[model samples]
Target: MPFKPSRRHLHTATYVDNKLYILSGFDDSIGIKGIAGIAGKQFFYLDVSVPFNTQEILWHDLTNINLVPSHIGAGSVKGGTNNNTIVLCGGRYLANAENKASVYTFDTRSNSWSIPTIIGESYIRRRRDLTAIINDDGKIYLFGGSLIGYNIVVNDMLILDTINLSWGKSSTLNAPIPRVYYGADLLPNQTIIYIGGETFVNQSLTLNEVYMYDTINDNWSTKKTSGSIPSNRAGLSAVLGLDGQRVIIFGGYRNNRIISAQDSLYTLNINTFEWTIPKIFGNIPGPRCLHKANLIGNYMVISFGMGYQQSESDILLLDISNNDEYKWVINFNPPISSSSPTSPTSPSSPTQIFAQKSAAAIIGIVIGSLISSILLTVGIFFLYKWTKNRRIQKNETSTSDNYNLQRTSVITATNNYNQSSQGVISTTLTNNKVYNHGRENEEIMKIHDNEDNPINDENIISEVTEIKNHGQESISVNNNQSSSIQNINNINNIDNNVVQYLKDEMIQVVRQEVNQLINSDNSNNNY
Candidate 1:
């Protein structure tokens, strides 16, 4: 039982739950162009759980539940907290009319589609052939796409907050050149990596540069890749590996008319920024462009695309579970009806042979350069760490010196206070002792002549009592001075400890920033 979709292109497919939803695209078989090109209104889905050869392998049409008109090249994303919702926005339906900025949503749980009210003051322009990626924060990011009616590509980045059902332009700076039909994939670190796309500049040349958008920081950076670089192409399909460490790019068109529907497959290691063509066994799909690749478990399912001679309806699968080897299998082949187009023969020309050899050489060079770059990056990182550590040590030393100075000042103040209080106590004690001795002598002599000197004895006794009270006050002042000196020493010690703790915290923060910088650098290289 062969299941096939109508010959179409410029469509979008998204995998949700266990099904792949194939949306509107231009159907050349219909040969009908009203305002826009011949576009299909039917919505089809396939149960991926069933084997491809099984009779159950068929696409179920859900167009009755869909209300929106047919469209092509719409930006879509599967988002929401549960990832059960698919939102499509901004596509072209009629060539003469303005591009559709209307937003539509499909609930996977209910199998229903509905238009959602967009609430925002910012004008959301209608675009087609745009790329949209969903972040972990439930926001869909739309990148460069063409303004259909105007025939202009825009570089504006828009963000749709799913939680609020609102749209706003992102404040990302230094974005890539405005282009369409680019290959894009999101990394685990919330960065969107965009590969080659066709730009209108220089008479519509394909771009080979790689650009990365940091979703967290709202910044863009260019990555320089070394290796057998793939030819500048657009309409390529990129799928991230299950481990989230590699991106596999397949089938794209090189010049305006040249389609790269061959056996060549490129794999990029995100960690090392390396590209390698893995040896694939079994039947390989023909060269094609504008295809969709979906990673399901250990298998990669590539759907319909424009092949070398005609539009392809076959589903190709590549088993990547084995790291050492890959097995390619054609999962589904559509039934050959009279309406099916015949496959054209692909001849290998001398130019093609030379191109292949050149590509191989480039791959060799890229591998060599990638290794060197990795080594250099590692070395630079270690050097940076060493420099940071040295700086931290110097800062700690300076802080310690400051702490010692502060402690010394506090100790000096305490010593001065102690000396002054001791001097005052000594003077008061001497005066009290001298006065008490004189009074005591006088009182003792008066006691001998008690009958004649009663009034003199009483005066001497009062003077002696007053001297003793003065001595007690002097002792109390000395005790207070000792306690104050102890407190000053304690405070000085606490201040020193606080300074040390602050220095440590500063060093920790510096280390953290350095680590973040290194990680960012590594990620950019992969982009």
Candidate 2:
């Protein structure tokens, strides 16, 4: 077949699976029903192949992988998780509904097309003329695009999970005000960076601010830009370079107030959040926006955007190596096939002795497994012992539902409960005596009136029971005062008397548990 004049506009093309896949765009010839004059359900693929023994490059049209026709929007082309599926999300296109939100996927392996069954997108008509970016993990994001009959762009962001065919909205706050024809990129840490889009106004102006979206944290942060900033221009192109660590932005428009091409390039260190204008080495491509950029090896293949008089710019190469060496190299060579051995070697030859010994090394794996099992058994035994003791300690902890009685010193330091509520009185307890506000010389007092009334130590038990009937609500009123009295006494009393009682009880319980464990271990050892 000779060169056919079947052409299209406002379409999307992506370089994937060693070939370029083309999808829906504006097609006036194919009109049907309400979708007449619209590029819907019309698409094709071109395979970049070099015929055997040929020196020329040829694009073979593959009829099997045609997709629905759709218009090209800002940052819509993206690759999937395995780099095997190319996902084309929201882009502006004229349809029966003027512009429709239609999504489709192209399978590289089978050269087939399918409208991915995505969740939460059934009612969404279209997300036309939007800025989008694909993160490192292959999640395609669409943000800030104009819908049907709307001159203003939207601030909503949607995420399409390519791996699972699920669509969800990300929580991004303080997003850049909605605009169209913007530049977008994904940083190394998966933060989506957006810049420079024209807003809807009588005198439409381009944005100078830069906004970043942290996909992992679902938060947005704005960077305060300083120094020489690029001219406010829309339709600029940006691509992530150096393993997504660096972002390179090129072309858009400037002070002319008209859509013009620009050669100025800017580099942003995604890690440091810094921008730098680097010097170009050789011939650089003239500034152009609404263009597409694809990273092939170390070079970026940039092409296809409106230019002055020249509507479609020729494909240019931006070399992102050490220096800003830019050139326009478009010829793509076919990948070479791997060479196979001419003759088969015998397995029993003397040269194969090393291979036989390597096979025999599998026995070492059995020995390693046995040793691992022994170590695991020992580890589990210790873990079980530790867990059992922890459980016993947790069970023995005192569980009291009673309110504690406040001592007289605690009540006085708190100034009859006035200071207690206001938080003016802070205290600590040492040897049952209160120390108030870092001061010394506070006296200890008996909580109950035992000596004055002929109430003996036996009465102490009854008074304690009565206080225990009160709840924590009453205790909250006195806790601050009680804490202050705790530090009044010396350290020896806390360490000797109070500690000795608990230590003796704990030692006896541990001894009994250890004896039982030892007996069990002995029984197992004998078995």
Report the error of model 2 at residue 219, Å: 0.6
TM, every model: 0.59, 0.55
Residue 266 alpha-carbon offset, candidate 1, angstroms: 0.6
Candidate 1 Cα deviation (angstroms), residue 378: 60
lDDT of 1 by residue, 277-369 (tens): 777888665777776777766777776666533433446678887766678865543222212122212368666675456435433443344
Please list the residue runs of candidate 2 whose C-alpha ends up more than 4 Å from where it truly belongs after superposition.
1-10, 24-57, 62-67, 70-81, 97-101, 123-125, 136-138, 202-208, 254-262, 308-313, 323-527
- Write one digit per residue (lDDT tens) for candidate 2, span 167-260: 8887747877777767787776778888777665522334345888998888888876554566677766677875567777776654334343
Lowest lDDT block of 10, candidate 2: 461-470
TM-score top scorer:
1
Overall lDDT per candidate, in order of appearance: 0.64, 0.52
lDDT at position 449, candidate 1: 26
Colliding residue pairs in candidate 1: 227-366, 228-362, 228-363, 261-287, 261-288, 262-287
